[model samples]
Target chain A: MAEGLVIVGGSYAALHMAQGARENGYGEAIRLISDEPWLPYQRPPLSKGFLAGKIERDALALKGEAFYRDNGIEVLLETRVSAIDRQARTVTTAAGANLRYDGLGLALGARPRLLKIAGADLDGVFYLRSLADTLALRERLARPLSIVVIGGGFIGLEVAASLATLGHRVSVVEALERLMARVLPPVLSDFMAQMHRGRGVEVRLSAGVQEIKGDGAGRVASVLCSDGSELAADIVVAGIGVVPETGLAAAAGLACRDGILVDDAARTADPAIVAAGDCVRYPSAFTPDPCRLESVQNASDQGRAAGAALAGKPQAYRAVPWFWSDQYECKLQMAGLSPGHDRLALRGAMAGGRFSLFYFRAGRLVAVDTVNRPGEHLLGRKLLAAGASLTPEQAADESFDLKALLAA
Target chain B: MVIYQLKDGSERRVDVPAGHSVMLGAVQNDLPGIDAECGGCCACGTCHVYVDPAHYGRLPAVEAMEDDLLSGVAAGRQATSRLSCQITMTPALDGLVVRMPERQG
Candidate 1:
């Protein structure tokens, strides 16, 4: 009998890999190893619905328990893989158990980049990554408390908005000059800042955290900033960003950079090993260089590609990247990559907080950002995936039917 | 319980609790053919389904956002086309029938 396929890690990437493998007819025994105590669950809602108490814990499950059992996917929860012995084709678990595999998958997702300043580890300072982190933060949010969210990225702004809506005093601090500067242009970033401010969140930009000060009981009391300003806080949440977990791959003698190096088929340098999701930087049609995307779309599509490879049917993954962020009553949807965009066109009324921004690079449609406009956003995904183009004038005109472009 | 009509002339009966969306039923059951990539947030249009004509009207009216999203599904839109995520399961909707598209965009 074959040793079967062994998948390491949990979350969308790992879960989808198992599903994809089974769906593609890889019938050998499948074992999924994860360090998380809980079954693989959705992480996006942790900051929004779950934090707001609108979505229950049971609803977070990606798939029901019976699904895994019925599919013959054995899930080993709370088991950490200490080392990978590529020569033996087995993984050593922390408990001294070695699991053998004919093929291996590295779905090791990213981890939260921690704050390194003094008092960073003090109680009341939290990072949102795992369900455990969110649950702890949720428990802390049971009572109204002053919160200084230390980032203006999507995660930070989202947590701030969720807490503010729950009637908590919230303040957002971003080291950048504008919110989400790394992704969105200044125009959208300004709109985000205004939206947070209108909802009673103090949006502070261009300020870096110097240190976190602890109280007499060793709990976070306030955050000291680089400009000598201090914000009182009963708790602090850092959403700086994430670092791809490439340690396992690197230790196993695989090529690793910012992420584990992988090909279009999510294959590493080793023929028997494949990687996907946030941990692997792979070639994409949308980017001039290999990039690692940390979105649900990337994880699911790339995991599917990895599964196909494991099933001996490797195909180049070409799924278009798309993402969404829900803050307050507004929904921000984005499609495609737009960092090199030289022009932008707007459709719909921005004054009412509902509009779409089209990004163009040298007269070619590259990406789009739609706020409260799901129609354009959805059309944008289809258009981008098809490599279709639109003139700036056509994209700006509200009367222009985007569906016609898709049909064409 | 819900009946999912597949493109291959097959059907899957899944027991989805009331208040959960129709997409969640297929996803949680590990049923193939329905890809709720965005986790039923209506962000991705992958979970497209064609409701059985007789039971179509029994579901809630499509909102503006969902209506706009329906036009862009990978499978060509049908008069009965609806994003499964937009349709919530109700006791009255028990044994509801929804057909998955040949492929999700």
Candidate 2:
């Protein structure tokens, strides 16, 4: 019997692992098991283009059916992996099928954190994570309706911008004083708040959601804030954050922290089984601490690394992490991690609506956040990947040629 | 139809509707080379391509944002380099040729 490679989840990481396995010359059966009914698709557009009705469902697919068939990859859709038997090298599915594998790849992605307040289970309450969620939300957005978004994270802000673009009255409530407080600097956070407010989005800062009240019809009607104010809402969305899915890895006796613990090669303690994407925590030069990333760049890079390792051509995963978010007219591009940064250098004037935030720690360039400035984001990725060093003053100089630094 | 001459010298001709971008044309055809990771948002530079110099000036003028992004391509960028996603397909520009770079960053 020819041994097969079994991969779990239907997100970017799982798809990339399959591609990597093929590219690395793993010729045996390649099986991808996904809980979603559809094939792997891009998720970034779920909040922007899909929500705004600019792209259709077919455009979201990462690979067509012909690609899978031509590549000799079998896809098991709407199937869930119940357990992994490490000793036997087999995985049991929810459909009562036990499949044996020579190698196992776990790309179990994260799930959205739900709001724990009252009326959380109401009909009109939604959380955007999967295609189904986006479809339902898009249906609700067909007509102009008042929307109340809880949390000021990327997902919340993206949804707010999408709903507002659809001509809906949208309000964002952030428990923190500014938007994107955890990832972005104070100045950028303040700028984002002003940008949203300027676009007629009611950005309520330093406000906590007390409860989501439902009408007698059992649909969300209004949101009650901790400040003793009620804001009428036709729909409510909660985008607080996501919790990594690691139950299967832990149940199978794999090492796990907040996520499944993997090495630089994306391999677990059991060499036969490997994990990647948001579900796995690994150390990278980009951050001082071990971290789990939820971006597509991390997923694709780590998935390729895991696949390469499984094919006996292991390569250390050391790519600079990059992410982008589209809100209104601004395209915010970020590269590298900014943890423990001591100083920030602004490349351009913020009033000009195009600038890049260069972060440095101990006078060494660390990360960058660029708004409508793709050149800076790209250069920052290269600089961080090369582990280059530069002073804060040099980074702040407008006449400095960032591309020339890469040549040096 | 928009013609994409890949880095490996293979040719893929895709029928891109007027409103769609050349990146979407390449992506919808599953033509290898264009990643379009941001879904034609012009945020990620994965869809970098070198427009054939003959048809480069005929298309719309490169915006400041697109010019900045093209400057950041991981691979060495040429004077003909332009992000395929920012170039919209039009009937007047039929048979436009774009060559893929060695690799997109």
Candidate 3:
């Protein structure tokens, strides 16, 4: 194993690689180069509790300095890796310092995609992807007024829910045919849309924002949709989604597609480098489809896996993916990938947001989305890992404890 | 009261009580930007901010989770890149300029 590991892009992947490199018995210098200039933090709450004001800022530290010092990891925050010299096995920073690395792991996570509307650049039309965005939104939230959020993805819906709880009039404009169309079932999305609307969020389906009009002062005030309707707002939140941050990788001549292309081993075109997090497209475990995910689980797992591999204990990244989001009082948890599913099996109380839906593909449980049911979600993760096939009867019966099925 | 410079070059004057993390202190006063998601347990790694290297020693010793989280954050974390939640305003960080990370995860 090399005596040093340098990981790039300080999000979940950067943190995991630093820790995993030490744990994997690589008695070497571990360094992380991050562009954000902050500690490795989790993003799940950016759209949930933190946005809702339930969680405070200091509570978000992933770890303190002791972990790095104890583990022999060097972290360079706020340093942007401007260029990766593939031939030299070195990275030059934005500040004009070049560092050599034996192995490199890129956790350069995805970024929120720019909103497709006029006046998106105007003040008050913000995206809910970063701490800064949430903090800025909170400034607008202080007055307890109306908020117009574009997109019905997880972030948008959660932001809508949080603003509604704060007594802000909320409206969500989703260009999608339905909410969470990529991850959720139609029925569940419908249920979720109802819940938000019930809380006074006017969710407009199939409504794409054609143009956003800021006030005379250059602050967002309303959105004009393709449907030729005007939606008023005190502020606009665009959770449209994200694109992988792979400019450095692509510039360095790495294979890039929807994400950096990697095998199960999380390796890029360069054997000396690897990629993880929402920025890489890798083989999926539950099915044949290659997937690129924006979930925290993927970022952490891929970072850890790539870190270990970079340490020469090369193993394919095949961990079951899981993620959780807090919307209002509802804790939505997902286990496995829900792609290519033929039907969804329901358990628990869906109406109250206390149930779960197990997605089955070819009679096998491929993925499960649970709301406020952690126990079932845990088992569902195991089920996905084990490729556990389940009968519909077993799924429909709430009396059928999922853990027991795991044992069987 | 302590004055801290945010990432955006704006100065935030936070009236922190005695013995509160600069991160939490800013948050308590309704500072618009710090989001500490783990309740300051040092887990979840969301409350990351870089302290001015010039004034790092004024802060408290970094704990285990704080270190762990920093390691994972984008490494520009300098001698000053601290989980702001881990920093207590000890009058030493009086004029500290803290910068926020672009994304928590």
Highest TM-score scorer: 2
Per-residue lDDT for B1-105 in model 1, tens only? Answer: 999987789899988888788898898887778888788777778899999999988988888778877877888789999999888888999999999889996
lDDT of 1 by residue, A178-197 (tens): 99898899999989999999
Q: Which ten residues in a row have the lowest lDDT in candidate 3 chain B?
A: B36-45
Q: Write down the DockQ of candidate 3.
A: 0.04
* Index of the highest-DockQ prediction: 1
User: Considering chain A alone, what is the TM-score of candidate 3?
Assistant: 0.96
In order of DockQ, best first, we have 1, 2, 3
CA-lDDT, candidates in order: 0.90, 0.89, 0.76
A best-first ranking of the candidates according to their TM-score comes to 2, 1, 3
Superposed on all Cα atoms, the candidates' RMSDs to the truth, in angstroms, are 1.8, 1.6, 11.3
- Model 1 spans > 4 angstroms off: B53-58
**Residue-level lDDT tens digits of model 3 in A35-113:** 7646766566677767778666665556655556667778888888889998999989989998888898888887788
lDDT tens digits, residue span A243-266, model 2: 999999999999889899999999
Error of 3 at A268 (Å): 1.9
TM-scores of the models, in the order given = 0.95, 0.97, 0.79
Give the CA lDDT, 0 to 100, for residue A315 in model 2. 82
